[model samples]
Target chain A: MNTALCMLAAANPVGHVTDKPINGQWYVSNVTVMLVLSGIATLWLLIPAAKRITTGKSGSIDDLRTRGVLANMVESVCLYLRDEVFRPVLGDETDRYVPVLWSFFWFILISNLLGLVPILDITAALGLNDFHGTPVGIGGTATQSIWVTGTLAVIAFVFINGTAIIKDPIGFLKHLTAGAPVFMWPIMVPVELIGMIVKPVALALRLFANMTGGHIIVATLLGFVVSLSTALGGVSGHGLAIVPLIGTIVIYFLEIMVAFIQAYIFTFLTCLFLGQLVVHAHDDHEHDESHGGEHAAAH
Target chain B: MQAMRFHLALVYTALLAGPAAAAEGANPFVGTIYQAIAAAVVFVTVMVVLKKAAWGKILQGLQDRENRIKHDLDQAEASAKQAEKTLAEYQKLLANAQEEARSMMESCRADAKKVSAELKDQAQTEIDQARQRATEEIQWAKENAVNEVHAQAAELATNVAGKILRRQINAQDQQQFVNEALAELGKGLN
Candidate 1:
């Protein structure tokens, strides 16, 4: 790997740790394919679910009353995310951002889950790891890549601050001083600024690190099983391998749970950040209204 | 404090996760710009596609369902109110009907009572008239019968007197004889 080069492919366990050429194009790699696949999976899953949700043009009572399991399950999760997870924070702005938030939720969730499928290993085992003398992969967790998560974080950051700044530019700038006196700008501004930058950076790192760490843990346990088998190289070795295999199984379960959790965490944090910024518009409006009421009362 | 801990854990994991890249002498914190761009591209594409395809329709459905339910509830409430009003009106009408029936029955009863009393009086008058007529007829007949008997007796007495004497009697004599005979008969009855 060129240590300094920034490319579309990143390292993984079973496939190319570096971007490889395929049909003379170096951009194609496992995470790329997985991202595309995740994108497709997201669309494939949600399109039908969307149909089930939409009912019809008239949206009749009986149609509204019933739904398929897929629609119901998808709807329950979406509702939870929309109403319960972020509604308090996002307030009136929840709808405006729900599409983006849901996209992130389902896409990231699917990507994270795809990583656990061992498709990369299966391809590598089937000797499809190298195709036409170029390395490629069929599956891996797209969200595990820092580029992917950081990009998502960057998008969230943009939306959060951009909307705030757009809606209330002066307030957005004023918030940089951490609500302290003008004299405190020397300290509070920088501190608040740092806090702002750190938030999204933390979101990206949290997801990337969690995903990377879980896979690593599972791999390490499996590595132990491999070493155990290799050291004895027989039935005894296979007998010795059971311990790490069990550990791998346990870690794999945890990884599965973590995949969902990390996706939820990313979405939840995005909403919280959005709420933190956008909800101020409502507060400002309320403040103005209160002031107006007070002036009227005085009159 | 919780956010700080979350960031700390992330930092700790990043350190733990980056050994292979570290050995490759790459900064793990930084990602490739191209991949970063790809990530943004892919995510934005998803957001756009989903926004177009699913989110709008799904949210609209939810809203429509809510509105439908609200409308159904309102319609149901209005219908219930109307039913209640109709029931109350029917009950009121029924009460009026029953009152009218009761009043009519009372009127009929009173009229029947009046007619019965009138019939009783008329029947009594007719019965009294018939009894009076019957009593007058019976008295007249009895008077006639008595007259007949007196006349016959007078004639017979007159004849007998004449026969005893073996002589003819005149009208004036006969009258005297009839009066004597009647007086003798009256004395004998006493």
Candidate 2:
């Protein structure tokens, strides 16, 4: 029963030894390792695709052709993100931000997918849970950790607010007051301010919660099989374990879908939030104002 | 103002940390600021590397393909227009040839009619000249025959008178007979 509880606790961020500080101000957690691995994995796949794309002569027939299925698949995803996802929201500025968004997408996706594998359980079974009393096994989803998601959200927050301010300082300041009259500034300012902070907090929590929650459910379901077996104290309990095992299998498939969904949601929402910050040209605003006036006059 | 906002955010984060830590027994809600810094570093590094390495290339390839497609379409349109123009020119040339052929055929028909009329007039003139020549020749032949016959007749008459005189006939009688005969001959010649 204690072992089952311990395994269930492993689903929590606090249960991992890497979350603790190894030295002063330096901590090496499972998430840190996963981040590095995700980065390496990203490089491994994309570098070859890049080579395939770049090595071809421009304007050649081969340039029009994709290198292979993997390369083509990667390119298709990139094109879809740029054209369908990013362009509609970011407009002309889509190109400038694609690299960052793509990096985030690939990183989060790989991290989520890697978490689905039972590497940590295998390592634990092998008695390699700690390396010389330091938690250094291959396991845990980086995106599941609040710190990782918080970091990503912070970065997005900075990009959104920073770009908004840089693009139009006066407009940004004005936007904060929600375009309200002088009388409403007091109420609107705090609301806008809170809204600004909330965007990043929401981004962080959404990813962290989805990932952590799915993992907790999966671990808990599997723990039921162990607890049932222990309760029966014989082959009878082992036979009953099939029920929870089936349930765990179903949840496992759900977790896979959840992983992809959460990554997409995070990226899509970031694009939406970033899109909001981009200021249209002044001419458009004047056109809108005139149109609004005409509409009011007609009314 | 920015610094004050930053401090306020930090205080807010600290205030939230206590409850978050107490809730999950290990506080999954509040992460160390260092983790956020590490993530930032990792993400930035990944972004920079990817931008330099792969993303730029892929985008360039896509752009190149787009431009190529545009250029090919433009060329195809131009060629189609050229073909249409060529077809129009050929059609015009064909129309001109047909018109010229029609005019040429009409002119040839008119020339044939004129030539046939000229040939008929020439044949009629030759026939008339041949008839006139035939008539002149018949008149000459008749004159010759008549002269010969008159000469023969005069000679025969003189001879007859001489015989009669020789037999003792009167000279005045012979002379009257000759004169009558000569007068009859002259009427016949007329």
Candidate 3:
């Protein structure tokens, strides 16, 4: 039980890196490796698709046809994210922000999926889990780490506030003041300011918690199998171990779903937040008024 | 001042609450600044590379494809409109030709009827004239034949009288006899 708990602990952000120091204050971490791998994986899938799309003859029938299956699939996902998800919210500004959003989504999704693969176990079975007491295997999910998710949230925070300020500085300040009556300014201003910080913090915590929680559940359930086997003697213990093993498998599948859901949620919320900042309060109000008036007239 | 105090209070509360607990031997909230920096660097690098290498190109391609499709559809619509116009013109022309043919047939029928009526009238007049002329000639011929018959009878009577008397007849007596014989023949013929 303790060993299983230690293994689960190893999945967390602080301890997931190798203890072996490469330099004075620098140490190579499993998450760093995963981050690098995810980046490379993203490039591998997208670069070819991009080349196929750009370099092909523009008006030919073959050019209009979807490139290979992989390229087509990638294009479809990108188009859906841009047209359906981001464009409706961001409007004409979708083009300006889509590159960053696309990178963030694919990077995070790949990182989460990497954690689902048992690369560390495979390396361990091959007797290559560690190199001279330094862990050198591919395992940890970078998004499960608070630091990784926190960085992403911070980047989102920068874009959200920066865009708001850049678009209309005075409006942004007024936004922080919450558009309240003069008497309620004292109360509303601080609340809105705190909300700014809280939004990204919540974003970071949500992703980290979701990814870590699913992993912990799977680890704990698997630990039960070993516990049950050890608790009972020999043959009966081995027979009873099958129960938790089945439970662990079920949770593992659930983790996979959670992985995709978390990635989508993170990207979706980020787009929504960015959209809020990009379009001003006055603009939103006008849009609402017009839309409401039209609806009433239609009715 | 009130807003500042509220801000401070919120921060204090957040710090006190801290973060959720982690599994044994791990602190969930405790992340190294180094790792955060590393992650930031990685994210920025990925964003930059992908923006330059893939996203821009992909978007351009999609835009191009949209423009091409729109162009093709516009051309198709234009040609369809042209085809529809041409069909309408052809239908109109065909209708005109059919009307002309119908009118021409009516005129031809009228001409044929007029020619047939004129021919019948001319033929009737000729036949009437021929019949009148033929009757006139026949009457003339009958008169001549009657006169010839009277003359021959008169000569024969004169000849018989002379023969009985065994003497030649005089000129004045012969003429008076012929006149009387011709007048009797004319009455008989009428």
Candidate 4:
């Protein structure tokens, strides 16, 4: 099958049109659908949430029934960050950074799911096969695309450090040279700069590598069927074909879980970084002192 | 804090490699998508408006609930005070009823004693009148018996005088004596 036909075939699980590929580079595949769906879903969720936060009525009757789902889901995510994730690490400074973290979580999650579709699995599926024969959206995992993950990382990088600088300009700069004495400044400065840039970059790669590696492994495993077919001249390949098919089924479920997890990890790390910058070092010191005091009194 | 920072550095080091490799691609920086840029603008605008509105309304709701609780508490206290007053009044009424019953019993005993004394006096007076009438009847019977005895004595004395004249004189003298004697006896008896 041609690149366009393969993509169209993969994009629609049902075989719609068997012939006539679309002209030029304009194309929609499974990955594209996943991307569009995610974007729509995210917006659909955020609009009512924005309204509720502004109006503060729990909402009107229609709003309660219709827009309530997305609003409720966003609120739950926000609440989780505030109560469980942010408060534990960042302490009282949690509130200031929660919105940004919430945004990051949802944006990354939707995109990761977009990467998991089979239309994006082409290059990986055929084992480094020619791109000319593959469909547009059929081969590129969205999250695996360095551009996509890198963009997300960059946003996190700017927000976390930016908020920190705004909150405590001196402290934000000083955190770079924080570990040792005045003599260590020259060495620490370079390290801190690198550290600053590395935070988001690492965030991007973690997501990218995980998605890419999983896709490649599944594709390579599926290619075994073709190899066996060739080796046994067709008969033995058919006998062993069911094995790879069963394996593909199991991998599919694992990929779904990984998609959600990778999204969480991306969001989680971003929040942790923000927490480090925004929360005061003195508060943590006080907490330690109080804890020590209790321990001493107990003794 | 140092440990946390160190951990973050480790995490970032691992991730930086992915983006660096992707930087070698045909178009490393694709700028931003139109949808993403739009979403970011919407996010900033909505967040500012929502922050102000949410904080204000939530605080107001808390205040309203507080006022309602205070009003309910005041009403309960007033009702308790009124109930206490009613209880005190009932106790006073019960005490007054007991005192009146005691006084009425005392007066009833006094009036009963006075009535008993008047009845005894009236019965005594009637007994005295009955005894005087019985004594007067007995005295009249005794005086009538003495008058009957005096008339019998006068008749006996006249009889003795007639007998003495008969024995001493003749028949003719006797007859004349009898006549004179009868006249004298009758005049003496009368």
Best by TM-score: 3
Candidate with better DockQ, 3 vs 4: 3
Quote the lDDT for A132 in model 4.
Answer: 66
- Per-candidate fnat, comma-separated: 0.39, 0.42, 0.42, 0.01
Query: What are the runs in model 3 whose C-alpha is more than 4 Å off?
Result: A1-27, A56-67, A128-138, A177-191, A220-258, A280-282, A285-299, B1-23, B26-30, B98-190
Docking class of 4: incorrect
Give DockQ per model, in order: 0.15, 0.16, 0.18, 0.02
Tens-place lDDT digits, model 3, residues A224-245:
5545554453666577668768
* Candidate 4 segments whose C-alpha is farther than 4 A from its true place: A1-37, A48-75, A119-140, A226-235, A282-299, B1-190
Q: Pick by lDDT: which candidate is best?
A: 1
DockQ of 3: 0.18
- On a 0 to 1 DockQ scale, where is model 4? 0.02
RMSDs, each prediction?
Answer: 10.8, 12.6, 11.1, 16.6
Candidate 2 backbone collisions, by pair: none
Task: Output the TM-score of candidate 3.
Answer: 0.69
Return the interface RMSD of the candidates, in order shown, one decimal each: 10.0, 12.9, 12.1, 14.9
Q: What is the per-candidate TM-score for chain B?
A: 0.64, 0.53, 0.66, 0.40
TM-score of each: 0.65, 0.66, 0.69, 0.49
Q: State how far residue B141 of model 4 sits from its true place (Å).
A: 54
Cα lDDT computed for each candidate against the true fold: 0.73, 0.72, 0.72, 0.55
Please provide, for model 1 over A1-299, each residue's C-alpha lDDT reduced to its tens digit, 9 standing for 90 to 100: 13212211133221223332334443665666778888888998888888889856554456774378988888888888888887776777788888888888998999899889988768767765354565444566788778888888999899888988998888888777646688989998888788779878888888888887787677655654654554344676677679879988999899889988988888887777666666775454553453344234223
Runs off by more than 4 Å, candidate 2: A1-26, A129-137, A233-236, A281-299, B1-27, B77-190
